[model samples]
Target: MPAGLVALALGGFGIGLTEFVIAGLLPQVSRGLAVSEVAAGWLISGYALTVAVGAIAVTAATARLPRKPVLVGLVVLFVIGNLLSAVAPNYPVMLLGRVVAALCHGTFFGLGSLVARRLVPPERASRAVAVMFAGLTVSNVLGVPFGALVGERWGWRATFWAITGIGVIAAAAIATLVPYWAGEVPAGGRAGKVPAGDRTDSLRAQVSAFRSTQVWLTLAATALGYGGMFGAFSYLAYTFTEVTGFSSTDVAWLLVVYGAGLVAGNMAGGRGADHNRDLTLIVSLAGLTATLIAFGLLASSPAASVVLVFLTGVFGFASVPGMITRVTDHAHGVPLAAGANVSASNIGNALGAWLGGLAISAGLGYTAPLYVGAGIVLLGLAVMTYAAVRQAHARETHSSPNSARSPDRKASM
Candidate 1:
C-alpha cells in the first residue's frame, strides 16, 4: 500500500473523531455553553444536515479544481472549525464551528474515494476505500473514548483543541504527500486507469447524472439498505437494556464489540466487492435482513443477542463498498455522483433513526425496530433486483443483431 493512503486515513480519523465525540460531550457542552440539553443536541443534527448539503454542493463546486489542492483546503477548513470550537464563547458560536467542520465531511469522502481508487490497481479499488474507511471505524472504537476522556479530565474545549492539532497534521500530510495527478490516468493508459473525463463544474452536468435509471436505483437501495441496518443500531442501547436485559455498563462493552465487527466487515466487504460487486451486495443485505429479524425474535436470549449485534455490524457495513461502486459505475465515473451517494447515505441515517423512533413511540416493544429495519432492507433487495433486470435488458439490447446494424452503433465501434 502507498504511504499516501495512510495520510488520507489519518484525515478521515480526525473527521470521524469530531463527528462521534460530540455525542459523548453533549452534557459538558450544554453546561459550558449555558444552554438546555435540547439546544446542545442541535450540534449533531446540524452537523448531519450540513454534511448532506456540502457533499453535493462542495464536490460540484470543486469539480474543475485540482484534487490535491482541494483536499488540502478541506483539511484547513476542518482545522479552523475545530479551533473555533475550542475557543467558542457561546452556544451559537459552538454550533457555527460544528457546521463549518461538517461542510467538508461528504465532499472529502467522495473525492477521497476517487483519489484512493486511482492510487492503486483497478482490482484494488475497493480495498483502497476500505483502508480509508478503516480510520472511521477506528475513530468510533478508539478516538471517541479517548476524546471523551480528555473532555472529562481537562475540558470539552480541550478535546476540540486536540482535534484541531490532528487536523493540522492531516493537512500537512495531504499537502506534502498526495500527488497532483493522484487520480489522473497517464498517457498510453499505462496506469490501467480510466481518465476522469471532462470537468463537471456546471450544475447542469451534475444534475444530468440523475437522469440515469441506475443512479436512481442505486440511491434508493442505499437509502433503504443502509437505513434499515442503522435503524436497528440507533436503538441498540434500548434493545440491550429492555429486551436483552443487559445493564447500562454492559452496553458500552457490547458496543465496542459491535464496532470491532464493523472494522472487520468493512475490510472484508472491500475485498469481496473487488471480486464480485453484485454477489457481495446481495449476500450482505440478505444476511443483514435475516440477522435483524432473528435478533428481534430472540431478544430474550442474552447470548444470542450479543452475537447478533456483532453480526448486525458486520452485515450492515459490508454493503458499503458495493453500493459505492454501483453508483459510480452507473454515473460514468462522475465524482459528484459519488458525493451525492454519500448524501444519500446520510439521508438513510436520518430515515432509519426516525423510523426506529416511530416504532418505539407506537408503544411497540424495543424489538419492534429490528422488525421494521428488516422490512426496509427487504425493500432494498427488491430495488437491487430491479436494477439487475434493467442492466441485463440494456446489455442485451446493445448486443442484439439489429442494434449492431444501426449506423450510430457502427460509427462508434
Candidate 2:
C-alpha cells in the first residue's frame, strides 16, 4: 500500500472521531454550555444533516479541481471546525462548529474512495477502499472510547482540542503525501492536465453517471441495507439496558465488542468483494438479516445478546465495501455518484432511526428495532437480487443474434 493511503486513513480517523466522540460527551457539553440534553443532541443530528447535503454539494463544486488539494482543503476546514467547537461559549456556537466540521464528512469519503481506488490495481480497488474505512472502524473501537476518557478526565472541550489537532495532522499528511494525480484521470489521456471539457461539461459528465439504472438500484440497496442496521443500532442502549439486562458501563464494553466485529468484517468483506462482488453482497446481507432476527428474538439472554451483538456488527458492516464498490462500478467511477451514495447512506441512517423510534413509541419493546431492521435488510436483499438478475438478463440479450442487430438495445444494468 502507498503512504498516501495511510494519510487518507488518518484523515478518515479524525473525521470519524469528530462525528462519534460527541455522543459520549453530550452530557458534559450540555452542562458546560447550560443547554438541555435534547438541544445538545442536535449537535449530532445537525452534523449528520450537513454531511448529507455537503457530501453532494461540496463534491460537485470541486469536481473540476485537483483531488489532492481538495482533500487538503477539506481537512483544513475540519481543523477550523473543531477549533471553534473547542472554544465555543454557547450552545449555538458549538452547533455551528459541528455543522462546519460535518460539511467535509460525506465529500471526504466520497472523494477519498475514488483516490483510494486509483492508488492501487483495479483488482484491489475494494480492498483499498476498505483500508480507508478501516480508520472509521478504528475510531469506533479505540478513538471514541479514548476521546470520552479524555473528556471525563479533563473536559469535553479537551476532547475537541485533541480532535482539532488530529485534523491538522491529517491535513498536513494529505498535503505532503498524496500524489497530485490521484483521482485526476483526464480525457486527453494525460496524468496532470484537466479533463478535456468546459466546467459545465465536466460537471454534466459526472452527473450523467446517474443515468444508469444499475447505479440507482445500487444506491437504493445501499440505503435500505445500511439503514436496517443503523435503525437497530440507534436504540441499542435501550435494548441492552431494558431488555438484555446490561448495566450502562457494560453497554460501553459491549459496543467495543461490536466495533471489533466492524474492523474484522470490513477487512474480510473487502477481500471477498474483490474476488466476487455480487456473491459477497448477497451473503453479507443475508447474514445481517438473520442476525437481526436472532438478536431480536433472543435479546433476553445475556450470552445470546453478547454473541448476537458482535454478529450484528459483523454482518451489518460486511456489506459496506461491496455496496460502495458496486455503486462506483455501476457509475463508472464518477465522483458525483460516490457522493450520492454517501448521501443515500446518511438518509438511510436517519430513516432507520426514525422508524425504530416509532416502533418503541408504539409500545413495542426495545427489541422492536431489531425486527424492523431485519425486515428492511430483507427488502434490500430482494432489490440486490433483482438488480443482479436484470444485469444478467441484459448481458444475455446483448449477446443474442436478434438483439445484436437491434439499434435500441438498452445499456447493461
TM-score of each candidate structure, all chains considered together = 0.92, 0.95
| 1-413 per-residue lDDT for model 1 (tens digits) | 88778889999999998898997799999999999999999999999989999998898888767777888899999999989899999988899999999988998888888788888898988888888888887787776577678999999999999999999999999888887789452222222222344334444445655677788888899989888988898899999998889998788778878888888888899999999877788788898899999999998899999899889889888888778877876665667888988999889888988999999999998998999999999999888777766776666677788885323221111
The Cα local distance difference test for each model comes to 0.84, 0.87
In candidate 1, which residue ranges exceed 4 Å CA deviation?
183-204, 405-413
lDDT of 2 at 42: 97
Cα distance off (Å), candidate 2, residue 209:
1.0
How many clashing pairs does model 1 include? 0
lDDT of 2 by residue, 326-353 (tens): 8877766667888898999999999999
Q: What is the lDDT of residue 148 in candidate 2?
A: 81
Give the lDDT of residue 206 in candidate 2.
75
